[model samples]
Target: MLLKTFRWAFAVTALGLVAGVLYDGWTALGLVAILAVLEVSLSFDNAVINAGILKKLNAFWQRIFLTVGILIAVFGMRLLFPIVIVAVSARLSPSRAVHLALTDKDRYQELVTDAHPSIAAFGGMFLLMIFLDFVFEDRDVKWLSWLERPLARLGRVDMLSVCLALIILLVSSMTFAAHAHQHGGGHADKAQTVLVSGIAGLITYLVVSGLSDFFESRLADEESTKSDGAGRPAVALAGRAAFFTFLYLEVLDASFSFDGVIGAFAITNDIVLMALGLGIGAMYVRSLTVYLVRQGTLDDYVYLEHGAHYAIGALALILLVSIRYQINDIVTGLIGVTLISASFYSSVRRNRAARE
Candidate 1:
């Protein structure tokens, strides 16, 4: 089963390595390997979250995710997205941006880094909404009951998640402004950019998530009227629900990739190498998501969802913090892995105790 699931990932890795060697011999190959590992390590929580969403999709959509979705992730997010950011942020044309990337990598990296504040604010707010909504919503299963229960109760208030997210955005913008002022820089433009970017992120989450939920609920209602022989509604999402869910997954992926794309410059500024490596990692993440869905891993290990969401919350905070401060990618990766590992251990204990 494992081999069946990961066969494509293995193929992609092999091809990526060969491409890396062809691009610049051994040195490029090493960087590609490091970047691949880095992307996988940083995106483990993403795979978990994706699995939670992807399982709802029908097989057709699932295939779309693995095939078309991979193309968008590898070329769109990993390569073209950075170029787009540079073009927009630097007021350069698309051709100029590509030229900059190819001819002057250091300058390209600088432009990308300079754009980080807005990128972080946008991605951070979107992810923050995701985490907040998960924690605030009432659920029968609680991984961190001590905290989740109270938050769930508070969630009874309509739009509390949105309210809280906006408040946090305000505070973060103010904090950025203050930090800039302290450093003897103009704060107005920076603060305004953060505020606007955050609102854009918040709106994006609302639109995408809201549309997905609306369609899914409608589909559920429609399906509930019919049943298979076992008297259960078909749970596989299709039509509009599947489309929106797929869209949500892609946006979620782009948000997650923002930091990794920027951070890849620290290892190597070669765009082709970065795409090759990150693409391989992305393939593995997709494979892992499919494996979890097929194996019913989430159903068996209840708290895995909780751990992924908590890791997302941590990442949201880290991205927000990074607007004014530098955070090591190692620290980010370790925090996510630690949360997931702890949850896995707790799940094992729960299973053993139940058997006893």
Candidate 2:
């Protein structure tokens, strides 16, 4: 069963190595493996959160998520997204931008990094959806409401998260904008475009998220009305809690992927390497989720979900902090791992205590 579960990962890894060797030789292939391991290690907590959601999803969506969803992560977000950022900021066409990525590899990062605002916008908007979805919902079996209220009294809604995002925008604009300006006027116009793109992205995030929430609530109401039965969904996937849990996991994955995605740039800018490195990490995350589901880790541990959610909160803050500090990726990865590993260990102790 374990081998079956990892079959695809092994295949992907094998294929990736083959591709790397053909393209950039053995050294590059080794780099890919190292990057993949680092990505997987950094994203372990994301796996636990994802597993929690995968347990609730129907088989069809699960397959779609594993297949189509991964493609989105690899090609759409990882590859195309960066190119899009480069194009929009540099005023190049998308096709030209991609050509630049392949040919003038030297200029690839210069173009992309110039579009940091857009990159931040994509990641920022996605993370915001996650924050609001998990933080705002009313849930019967909540694990994090204890921490949610003080944040709530600040606003009935999860205003704090929004506040945090706004503060980030303000700070980023203040800091990066000046630096961008100092870089001079020719780049100045493009920098403004990037800055505006980030703001636009934030606004887009608010609109998209508000709509998703509205539709989800409506669909949920309709589903609840139909289920006029006695017991809840046998899987405990029925209530607001479950919905938020699902939302939380998706957003958590997005958050965890943020650094991996950004840091991938620091590696070879080959789309294949980004895909393989992050894809391997993604595969482990998917497996970890299944492992947790099969083991009933969340149910058994009780506080595990809380710890993970708290970690998400901290991760978000860390992301915001890193916007300025440019804190090295290794340190950021370590902090995330330490918090999550501590949570997992705590869960294990609790589980043992109950068994005793």
How would you encode candidate 2's per-residue C-alpha lDDT over 95-179 as one tens digit per residue? 9988888888768777665555445544554554455546565544444456666545554554665666666666655665444
For candidate 1, write residues 1-356 as lDDT tens digits: 99999999999999999999998999988999999999999999999999999989999999999999999999999989999999998899999999999999988888888788889999999999999999999999888899999999999999999999999889999996347422223677788888999999999999999999999999988887796766556769999999999999999999999878877888998889999999898899989999999999988888898999999999998998888888899999999999999888888888889999
> Candidate 1 — which residues are off by over 4 angstroms?
177-185, 228-231
Lowest-sum lDDT 10-residue window in model 2: 231-240
RMSD (Cα, Å) for all candidates, in order, is 1.8, 4.3
Clashing pairs in 1: none
Error of 1 at 247 (Å): 0.2
Native RMSD of candidate 1 (Å) = 1.8
Clashes of 2: 1
After superposing candidate 2 on the true structure, give the runs of residues whose Cα lies further than 4 Å from its correct spot. Answer: 128-160, 176-216, 225-231, 234-256, 322-324
Best by lDDT: 1
